[model samples]
Target: MPAAKSDSPGRVRRIARLIFRVCLFGGLAAIATLVVAVLVTMASLPSFADMMQKPNGQTVRVHASDGSLLLSLGPSYGDWLPYDRIPAEMRNAIVAVEDRRFYSHPGVDPIGVARMFYVAKRLHDEGRRLQGGSTITQQIARNIFLSSKYSYGRKIREAILALAMERKFSKAQILELYLNRVYFGGGAYGIDAASRKFFGHPGDKLNLAEAAIIAGLVKAPSHYSPSADAQAARDRASVVLDVMVDAGTLTPAQAKGVNLDSVTFAPEPKQNSVRYFTDWALSQLDTIVDEQAAPLDVWTTLDKRMQDAADASIRQNTPKDLQGALVSMENDGAVRAMVGGTDYVTSIYNRATQAQRQPGSAFKLFVYLSALEAGVKPGDPVVDEPITIDNWSPRNSSRRFLGPIDVRTAFAFSINTVAAKIGQQVGFDSVADMAHRFGITTQINTHPSMVLGTSDVRLIELTRAFAAISANGNAVTPYGILKVSTTDGTVIYQREAVQPRVLVAPFVAAEMTDLLQTAVNVGTARAAQIGRPVAGKTGTTSSNKDGWFLGFSSGLTTGVWMGRDDAKPIPGLQGGRNPAQAFSAFMRVALQTRPAEKFATDPTLPEWQLEPDDEAYFGNPDQGFGGDGAPAPEAQDEVTGEVPDVQPAPGDVPPPADTPAAPPRAETPAEPQLDQRWLDNVLRDQKRPPQSPPRGN
Candidate 1:
């Protein structure tokens, strides 16, 4: 049968050649299409040729008013480092883990592309995230221009731009750009910032392990940042070390010998050390300086020494659960120091400037001042006996009430009954008006209890009021950021202190100062004495929910408040306790460097005398309750359950400070029947001395 005649060798060769030609043609067509696509993508990409020669972007460096670094805001980049300054270890570690064939590849590694697809398929089947397969150049392209969203178009553009980059710059130049631009966690935009943020050092100082850790972060900055999670960073570094060894950039023995245990992380980023002040200043920045107007120098009015002292005092003295706030102002209303809370990091709530807590008895200043405005003298008789106004009854901090006390003694001891009676006599509207005139901006409810300090006020407003009192009734508007200028020395904003306005007669404030001095000298705020003459009042809510001390020397006014954010009572807390102590502690340090000063006093006034009846107000300090006074009322407010310990709640009174037996309910003094002529003068901001030679005496 011709032995199944096999085809001739020539015929077989011809058929094999035809089949090979067809396959080759198909491959050539595919290559040509890809090249054309690459060209089109390259046409749209920007020039990377001279990018390294030009500045990337500028950062907004923030400085304290004193010219010290505070924190930096953004242009989304950090200091650019030359390639040589960046440690070799840092660059090598990056190359090892990110792209081993980086130097040899024209731009993109086809081998890497294959492995990426293999891993992607496996991960997709397992329902895991598809990992990035970008080479270093491709990553640079994406970071510089293209979007990160996964799509064929992005990948194509990224690859074409990477090829373009390869042609435009050397390997070192590309790596330099990469290190200077890639984000490395924190608010860091590049290696320099990342290094400083995590290690508290610069890029040139990075050790092998540090470099490896940084290299590891290229994959996921936030998740593996040493600042956020040291363990995660360390583990990732180990992986990077292994990759380095496999890439021949590091030896296995060397990698094994590296210790990650000694690595220390920087404190949490933006852990806002001075958040309250920073926030306030930053807000002002918007109005005064254009955020985009280059860098600026903001000179704040803050005294660093005072701020530190206040922060420490609040932290060390207040109970952990109990929050505290403080604001210290110069007599001219300059905020020298402020502490918004125990921790600004855990919470950014600025209690000193933002919180509107009841001033407690601290608020009695307005009531007493109002009475003074109505022609009531500091020595005028003020009955502290049991008094009921409508449905409200007020008592002293100590439950026992002294029968009849002078207005000065009543204010010094923060007698709630006397203050409430005074508020009633002068009219609640008048008292509220006085507070508004002094600096309070929060709404004031004109209920009878208002005199007991049930009205809400910000710590800053109340502190400024004390400043006004110290300045002899001249109202001061508190201010920070004294001046702001451009980095190049162009003054953009300058704060000019306005001449203080007269809120009350200078002599009236002076007399009030003499009366309040008694508080720190022998009454409730005794804890606040700074060994210098201080005029201030103590305030505690009936529920012990808020405690406060507002005081001032002739030069500085300081106020402190301690309470729970939720307004819950802190058992045993009082105005004379932590709040007063903190104020004193802060003042002791704040005033240590300054000349000791005292509040101006009007000695010719009867304010210095203590009546025997008022002496019974606080029974002998040794023996608790002494006088036969009304029993202390309940700590809870009858009008509202929100009893701030600022003043004695209706039922809450001073314990047996010596007092006479419950005196008959005194008739509310008819608005002092002042001589119409004298009254008209007082209402006109008269500064007459409190001890004037008699109108009728």
Candidate 2:
């Protein structure tokens, strides 16, 4: 009976052993099937993220304010330094923090996994979650192939894939890939941009302190951001410096030399002072560079010196509460400087290239150019007397007839009546065509009012038109960029705005320039006259709001505009006052360094004999004045010989015309009325009274 019982026990033990064996085999089979299923799923899935294309090792363009290039973009591993160019210290920092036993273990670290599991279990008991042990290869796999879903199943797959990746790549290869893929924030995807952002220097040029700060950012970019948290970032950098020292990546003294405080994590990016030019240049990026490589380098014809001068002049000379713009371009249409507005930070309305305002008397240049083409000579007389055409009787600024003035004098003084008559005789279409040929891209209406510069034209187009005069009638459109290169210095595109010549004749342009110079010398634009010879026109719209000064020298052409953005009239401010002042200030500095040169003249342009008859253009007015009765002569005090209020001349009544009436006759206001209501409103809103009236009263 004892033998049988013992046999039964043995049988029972054998059965239990068999059951255990079957269960273990089934578990193995299930695990193999699951592994195959995960592999199939991963294989079938699309890429986790689009791979960033690296042209010449990746890049982003950095352009100067005037569209000139400061430099090109390169990789974090020492720009163009290749994977092998990585410093041993950086390599060590990455390896030590990411994977201490990277060389000794396969892609999946079993010891690390065991330790992580113990930690995770402890944390779970405390109702917390912790990171799983992810090896460098595991992270690479996840970055390249898997979604960052942070799931248990994903973790398992990551471990398996990591092991698989280890079989395919060497430790060094994996390390390099990991270093390049890490995000360091502030638009810096890799160490290169980070190095630049933090140290104002390149990654390869980084000292031990800068390197430590950058290395520390990988742990928690925001937490160690130098700009946002300088102290924390410095502390973190100190820890990195100590680690690097212990790793012998840096000497003790070298680490000590690295002042963590000296490492600025967020260095101020170089600002583009020439905001208008930079904005215009960026607008041309699509045409200048390949759409696929727009983030590359762009080289332009922008002259920094000229840009600085233009900007300073615009800001310093523009009146308070007024918008201003200045643009400077080379004779060939390469924009050297541009001031879009007084302050680009406060407002980005690029008045130089975008804002379109009436050209005012500046438009008379086109009218005069047309009349010249129509056989009218510069010295030909044009009557500045009252003239009417279809009920539009334009008057001069002085509102008094200037009989038999020469065309040169008429244009220089911006005589409205003479310019209108010339427009009538030459035909508005002819003048419009001349403007078009001069690179006026904006539409121009063919109306008599167009003669007085009624068309809306941006400063960019105006400057380009003036460029024709500087180029001896050869028109060249202004552009921002000259060449674009890939991140690795591969020239992708080049631009030079030298198109086929579009002008009547170089000599015609030279002659026109000669007449314009007279305007600056002793005419309406006298304020713009520099010691050096300059040519330009002053313009004031009928509303006295928009004022303009378009001028140029042999090497450059510039346009200045002053006006309120709201188009509100500015009393006492005229083109010659503010616009010309700003233009003169800018040109003085801009042309200081430019060689004193002169535009070439061609004496063979369509020759026409000078006609000195002013009556031909002015003719006669059909009717007499239609306003209040003529005033009497000035009254004199017999006792003290004091002059009394003067009266208008007999039959000198104001004429009815489409042109805005001459501003109200100057008068001394009463003390109570002397305070401007508009100014009072401004001061009242600020809880301040208007400053005491100036002593001028």
Clashes of 2: 1
lDDT of 2 by residue, 1-697 (tens): 9899879988999999999999999999987986676566556543322323332234556575465555444433334333576666677776666677788897778799889989999999999887747877887778666777888988878877776656655676667666666666555656666776766666566665666677787778877877668788789878887777776566888877766665445555544456567667877676655556245777777787777677777766677788888888877777888888877767878888888898887887788888866767665545557888887777655544545546766666567788888999999999999998887889999978788888999888888887777777787778767777765777878764455675866556766776677566445565564445578887777657787889986577899998889998765456766677667666666666555554353111101211234222111111111112222111110111112122332222132222223232222111111125633542343343212111100
lDDT of each: 0.73, 0.65
Q: On residues 1-697, what C-alpha lDDT tens digit does candidate 1 reach at each position?
A: 4543555666788999998898899889877876776676667655555554333334555555467766666544556788899998999999999889999998899999899889988998999967688889888888777767888787877888888778767899889989988877766767887888788887789999999999999899889988778999999999999999899989989999999988887776545436687677667777766656366667777777778778877876677678889999888877888889988878889999899888888888888888887888776665667888988887654455555446665666667787788889999999999999988999999999988888889999999988898888888888877777777888888877586579988768877787777666556675565555677887777677898888987488999998999998767677766677677667767776666554456322233333344223222222222112221222221222332343332322221222212233222111222245534543442233334312211
- Candidate 1 ranges beyond 4 A from true positions: 1-66, 70-81, 99-101, 104-135, 138-163, 200-202, 245-254, 262-273, 319-321, 345-348, 499-502, 596-697
Best by lDDT: 1
